[model samples]
Target: MKSRFLIALALSALSFSAFAHVGEAHDHGGFLTGFVHPITGLDHLAAMLAVGVWSAMTTRRLWIAPLSFAALLLGGALLAQSGIAFPAIEPMIAASMLVVGLLLAAQVKLPEAAGAVLVGAFALFHGAAHGQELADGSALAGMVAGTALLHTAGIAIGLGFRRANQWLPRLAGAAVALMGLNMGWSLIAG
Candidate 1:
């Protein structure tokens, strides 16, 4: 069972490479091109998935938290484009993954509003990262939309696993937190 879960995760991670750079130098204009950016990158993927898993474990209102995250992510991207700098944005994003992962692993339950706010804060950083990658042109909207779709997909997967086995959520959470810690260490090392 564990191996099967790992295989699923590996497959999901592999899927990311296909959509990693939605609007890079190459201009492949299509829905799939617009939708693969978020899941492609490890940092974005982990952070987004953590939000979903944590929200699922902590809140009764499941959809609300993820939706709030999507909305705030868009807002953050706009802020990034406007040169609104956030201190420790990358570090914070990594921390978010770690915190959310820990919460899920421990099965800690917080109020719905608190969970939303927490995830929203992280979403801003994630969005800003995506915004930075986007070119300043018509592709921006599509890129942003694509990122949101990827994020939503990650959340959905997390929620689905959470429903199947109670332990699965915690295991997913631990994986996310470990990934975050790796990111944090990389940032510090560099």
Candidate 2:
């Protein structure tokens, strides 16, 4: 079972290459383009889900977790759009995945405020990446909605499998952390 899960996570991480970039071929400002950006990136998707899962596992205030992530994610996106430079944005993004995954796996239960701040910080990286792709307000809106939906999915997964088997989330978190190491290595190696 563990082997199978690892295989699946590997396969999913392989899709990171398809992540949308600024000035890509289809780089038009629109809803669908922005909507697909978050989901397309394995790092982003995993981190988002991990945050949601961690929130659900640790707190009954499930809604608060996603809300905090999305709000701050939007803020980061806006900051990115303003042509502001955030050094090591890429590394931060990958690290967010690793940390969030670890948190989920560890099942650490932080205070709600601390949890919000944690996710908010992670969101900045993700939002910056998002800003690069979305050049228009509509696109930004779509991306925000899409991110919310992803959070919902993560929350569902976290809540869904939590009671069935606590190990499931931990396993998923470990896989995400491995993916983060891979991403970080690629950044350094490249």
Candidate 3:
């Protein structure tokens, strides 16, 4: 079962090339594009998954962080759609990856509410960034659905890792953190 799960996870992770980019003109619109955006963007993907993994490892109530993240993500997107500008969006998104990744790696357990607030704050930025690019209401729904699906996947991965080996999740978290660091550096240096 573990091997099968690992294979599936590996395949899913490698199935798509990164396709989303900030400031690029998207000719496509609607649900499909919105759904694929989070999966295709490395920053979004990493952070979303890390949220799930961290949540699973730390909290007895597994749903809180992911729920908070999804809710705030939608809110952020709506705010962006309404033409409200959020400052430091890209930087903050990058920071989400770093922060979440570190939290997972360190296995830090905060109160569920605190964790929810932390993840939700980051979700707002992520939602705003993606929301500005989408064209319709359906797309927003798709994005949120897709994000929730990814969170599910992350939770599964976290659980599998926890059962298989204690260090596995931490290693995954460290990898996520490294990715975040690289992403942040690219944003800064680019």
Candidate 2: tens digits of C-alpha lDDT, residues 77-182: 7897787766777788778877887888899888888888888987887887788767788888888888998999988988897776777888888877877777
Local accuracy by lDDT, each model: 0.68, 0.78, 0.82
**Model 1 spans with C-alpha error above 4 angstroms:** 1-34, 136-140, 151-155
Error of 3 at 49 (Å): 0.9
Given candidate 3, what's the lDDT at residue 40? 79
Number of clashes recorded per candidate: 1, 0, 0
Between candidates 1 and 3, the lDDT winner: 3
Sort order, lDDT high to low:
3, 2, 1
Q: Candidate 3 at residue 146, lDDT?
A: 92
The best-first sequence of candidates by TM-score reads 2, 3, 1
Residue pairs with colliding backbones in model 3 are: none
Evaluate model 2: give its lDDT.
Answer: 0.78
The worst-scoring run of ten residues by lDDT in candidate 1 lies at: 14-23
Model 3 misplacement above 4 A = 1-20, 25-28
